[model samples]
Target: RSDRNNAIRSPTSIDMDHNDQDEVPTASLGTWIFLVVVAAVSFWSQATVTEERFVPALNVIANIFNIPDDIAGATLMAAGASSPELFSSFVALFITHSSLGLGT
Candidate 1:
């Protein structure tokens, strides 16, 4: 997901007309439609109202993120979804001087 562009000149083949125009091809129509559908599903399920739907949504996100093992990634994502709870747990442990909530 990184794009590297260098502006330095090379010592070789300088005599040629180095136009240096780059082409960036985009995703095809099918791919775009597929991704749009997937994104719509992901957002639709990121809510508690449709409680039974988020699992597939998270799985799709994991795949789009190039992660292996949908279940494991989904678990990690679920844990991350409750950021406030995590922060609260951390503060409570700190005030109580406990090593709790530190174990993965």
Candidate 2:
């Protein structure tokens, strides 16, 4: 059986809702805005927080780096999320510094 996805022509996605009956452009515009905002936030999280769980973080950062002047103003959003992880990793690293802690 052929894959359903194979039928589609365009490989990349750009959200464009087309229905001929109603030509209200507002909804489509709103969709674009939402996508853009999400991409921006994705960019910031990935870019700034150089922590280990940096997959999503990197994606968000890439959006910012690759895109135009388009990062959402809240740059610290990802850093805020990363604080707990960062703290824990720091503590782990500290503990690992001493072999004394390794033995019960």
TM-score of 2: 0.24
Residue 52's C-alpha lDDT in candidate 1? 63
lDDT of each: 0.67, 0.60
Report the C-alpha lDDT of model 1 over 12-92, residue by residue, as the tens digit.
645354655544567899999999999998887666533666556666777787767756555756676787778877876
Runs of candidate 2 with Cα error greater than 4 angstroms are 1-27, 51-104
TM per prediction: 0.33, 0.24
Global Cα lDDT for candidate 2: 0.60
User: Residue 78 CA error for candidate 1 (Å)?
Assistant: 16
**Which residue pairs come into collision in candidate 2?**
42-60, 43-60, 43-61, 46-57, 46-58, 47-61
Give the Å error, residue 20, model 1: 5.8
